[model samples]
Target: MRPQYPFRVRHADVWRIALPACIAFITEPLAGLVDMTVIGRLGDASLLGGVVLGALVFNIILSLAYFLRIGTAGLTAQAIGARDPADGLLHAVRALLVGGLIGIGMIVLAVPLLMLSGWLLAPGDGVREALADYFYIRVWGAPFSLINFALLGWFYGRAEATTGMILQFIIHGINIAGSIVLVQGLGLGVEGAALGTVLGQIGASIIGLMLMLGHYGGLGQIVDRVRLGELFQRVALKRMFGLSRDLMIRSIALQATYAYFAAQGSRMGDIELAANAILLNLLFIIGFFMDGIAQAAEQLSGKALGANWQPAFEEAYRLSMIWGLIIAIVMGFGWYFFGPYIISLMTTRAPVQAYAVQFLGLAALCSLTFMPAFVFDGILVGTTQNVVMRNGMIASLVVFVGVAWLAQPLYGNTGLWLALHAWFIARGIIYWWALRRIRSRMFAQ
Candidate 1:
């Protein structure tokens, strides 16, 4: 007779993880909100436009390297599931090293990247100058930012959501305080905003490193267990590289879609671009909240897969989806009712507020679709199924482009948003189909 095992997922466990993660994830966009709010108070649409464009450029660039966070979380969770502390340590170390290297590369290539981005964006002179100032100062934070990504990923993968939350709080708290001081108190303008961001990143990286060392019982112990040679073992390195490469491709496609959205908005004029930025901030809030649930799914599902516990994986998937949908519905209602207030808080510009309010309803409708798309992302990443994720993102990107082509000519900015809505829906549908196939194959064993 076969042995029996208990595999149950409780709502309490999900909430325990999701709540802290929600707090942590939300801090990210809050930082952006703070930046926008401070700059918007400057009462210059060009300044807001410049900051928005510059931030979007960095967002796209950094998102390409997001595999450091995502791949580390998935790998570390699996290692923990297999009860291998050494493997978990090695994954974190490897991710940090790679992230550090990539961050440096970004710094080295910053000049050409800025030039290219400027050429493509082709903003008015006022906006371009502001973008240049912001980008130049902000690029210095790349190494620290990437390092924090690895640290946060490792913590989240270990189900140490509280630590992740604390780290994010530290980063954002310092950022918000510094931005207010530099931009408002000191009159440093866009450059001040960028410098404040750099300071926060540098502080977070240092503190996060100290915390990591302490978590592993100091540097001596970590050094002893994380053998340099072991980190480069042929099989493990192959798997790591494979996962990172695939995820990078997937991230680039995803970022490209957003970059396209921002670019299209820019073409509509500064007021429109600024308005889109404010509305998108609301979307970011929604995404981060739903991502809290996805984070739970990643950890739980990865651990389940590592242990070869199919039932546990199923339960994790089901409960995560349930909670995610619930939160999504609640957020949809909140945004519908409170979106104008939220937009007002981000910017005092009358035109920007009016334009953002026009599309707030569409943005709310899109929130309902984020849960399935994002939760499935967590599930697939946890299982290390990067190939399917990559394919689905690419396929969805194609659909978005096609739909935007047709819709934009007919409906303007509303058409662009409609394309975005379709993209989210398509991603969810594609991932769901992929999930079914993966379930059949994995469970059939």
Candidate 2:
């Protein structure tokens, strides 16, 4: 007889966690899609390009602080797995404090950040002016956005995917409605789009906090349970800081790869940049869809590790990969068939639409490669193996830079897309290798 696997995870169990998270994740890019669609319909490629560049700048900056979400999720999942609700709450509180401080710092430094990004992107006068208008308005939402990130992370870590989904819907739904009104109805253009996003973020932050308080049996109980002295003890602080530091490094590397991609496209011209932005939105949709499965892996694997159940971890890993692969294949086929139609719907500009269609095939292929990389990210984050994660991202980024340098001069934009695919493949391979080396060490304990 064939040897049996250690355990089997039910399809229902995986989907129970994944479906809601997937819905939540898709809403994020859905909001972006709305923004792009509104700006694209304005009959000015420069406006679209400006929004794209401005969004990129915000992503690079805000994503650097994503450790607040990631670190909290990993730590809280493990705590919950251990049946330590108080400890989980402690992790959430600490993460919120850090996120709040970081958000404030971002606001304080917004001017320099905008100036530096403007200098680096160096768009044409029209695009530059639009970019400034968008950035100046949207930067104020940094704190609330970070707070909401922590809230979503905390909810997911607790295996409350439905609640997370509701929160995400609230945020993005308001964003979509507001964008439609401000950009299309009021004709405020890019600045209105930025304001709509900021308003959504701020509103979500408030509602999320209220829900969190209700879940924890009010503010008094939460405060009583979270002993500041113990929570911020030297040892606890070290562990939290260490995890955040490593994740911050990993995030910086990942963001740098995309930032480089966008900067290069900007240099190629406004049409090329706008085309790439459309394609990149498609990539984001794929990434977020895959991230839903990754989120499942994170919770299940972290719980297994905390409970000292090796078989559970193995089962979680197996099922996550299976589902991730299936979804990625479906997405790839869908993109291959319907991508041009989707591009046409976003913009009336024929050149931009045509250029995006030319690259749609490459984007579809990249989606297939994203599966392992994204799932492995969830597993590592769940395990709080930040050092390994950081190292792997750094290695993949080096490969991306090297590949882009060698290929871009020869093949132009196609070469850049090729480099992006290489980056995804490289990340998957490196993380797989690292996981293999660490598996026995992690489980044997």
Candidate 3:
């Protein structure tokens, strides 16, 4: 360790985590942006709709498996903070093993899962058929995708932000470039785009694995270093499961609720659905930027917890909030002022355009309320404050459903978005309340 800001207990530790993450996440959208551009040029509305549905499929499967990363980061942070290399290595091993299992399971269940997704979303004929094509081709990358999640999560937990940044650039970069060439140069259409995405993921996973070989010591050599009995132990598995369990519960609740909002949009009409999707992706510009800082909080707080040093934890939290709020305020204004232009860039539909204006207005309003909750989430995860994270999200889920019922009837699609915005505010409140345990202390005595 060169003893940088985060290492020296310096301020701005959150930036250390967030800056790279934000940059990485920003570039990440390039692939999707390119895909959408290509699909848009296809001159067929069905093709566009199919890509949207395909995205939903990918997000659903990948989102459910997010626990691999969350669990790895939390545990890794603790180990790093405790100054235990063994802890880091073991956490990495566990995440890889779990990721492997998840990937295998998903592959086997692909047919049923895709079928279920189609039935659940109830997409119309054109979109449904297009989505079916995208799903089949893209789902082949399941194993690599899961492993990549583990690699990123493990690195993030260890506060190795640069590694994640490098991998993301390579991964998303390939995805963007590959999609462009396949879809445009080869004229493979939507299928080409999907294949490009899968190839990009596989390539990124291979690189990540190679990095593990020397970037931190090959993840594959674990058995030789430790007894087989140790790897399969009940206690170790239980701890990983425990952390993942809480995160899975939170993710499921939060994700399912978001899906509900999406379904609500669908019910309102395709115009609303299209508008919401554009607005939501635009919002990602802000959310992903903030996610970087939150990722930082997770690493710093987890390590602080392991060190049993309350002061470092406070420093990490304070810095995360500082950066999170700054990004929120600045981005909120940007979204408010220039959002119309951003939305206009995505589609040519006039009705969808009209509705997007209203939807974006609400998105800006919620940005303030949303940023803290997001950053705080990473903090709580790092602190292994799982119970509050889980419970608080569940509480907000209820409010979201309740408000959606009332608002959707009165305000229609805008009301549905408003309901979600409220849920965002509530999400922050819960985590802010939960951090009381270590918030009061400046340092360990």
- On TM-score, the leading prediction is 3
Candidate 2 residue-wise lDDT, 1-445, digit = tens = 2122233456776788799999888877778879989999999998998898998788888888888888888888888777785748888888888888888888899889888998987899999888989988898888888998898889888888898899889889988999899999999999989999899989889999998899889999998888879878899889999998999999989878998999899999999999998899788888888888999999888877766667888889899999999999999999889999999987899999999998889878987887899999999999999999999999999999999999999999999999999999999999899988888777664
How far off is residue 85 in model 1, in Å? 2.9
> If both were scored by TM-score, which would come out higher, candidate 1 or candidate 3?
3
Q: Model 1, range 1-445, lDDT digits (tens) per residue?
A: 2222345678987887899999888888778879988999999988999999988898888888898898999988877776774648998999899889988898899889999999988999999889989998999999999999999889988889998999899888999999999999999989989998999989989998998898888999988887768878999999989998999999989878988898899999999899887778678878988989999999998877766678888899999999988999999999989998988987899999999999989889888876799999999988889999999999999999999999998999999999999999999999999888777565454
47 in model 3: Cα distance from truth in Å? Answer: 3.5
| Candidate 1 TM-score, true structure as reference | 0.89
- TM-score of candidate 3 on Cα atoms, chains taken together: 0.90
Provide backbone clash counts, one per model.
Answer: 0, 0, 5
lDDT of 3 at 14: 63
What candidate 3 gets wrong by more than 4 Å, as runs, is 1-8, 124-129, 216-221, 269-271, 358-360, 411-414, 437-445
Better of 1 and 2 by lDDT: 1
User: Pairing residues by index, what is the TM-score of model 2?
Assistant: 0.89
Tell me model 3's lDDT, rounded to 2 decimals.
0.82
lDDT of 3 by residue, 201-310 (tens): 89988888787777546655655565667777899888778778888888899888878987898887899889888887777778888888889889988888777776
lDDT of candidates 1 onward, in order? 0.88, 0.87, 0.82
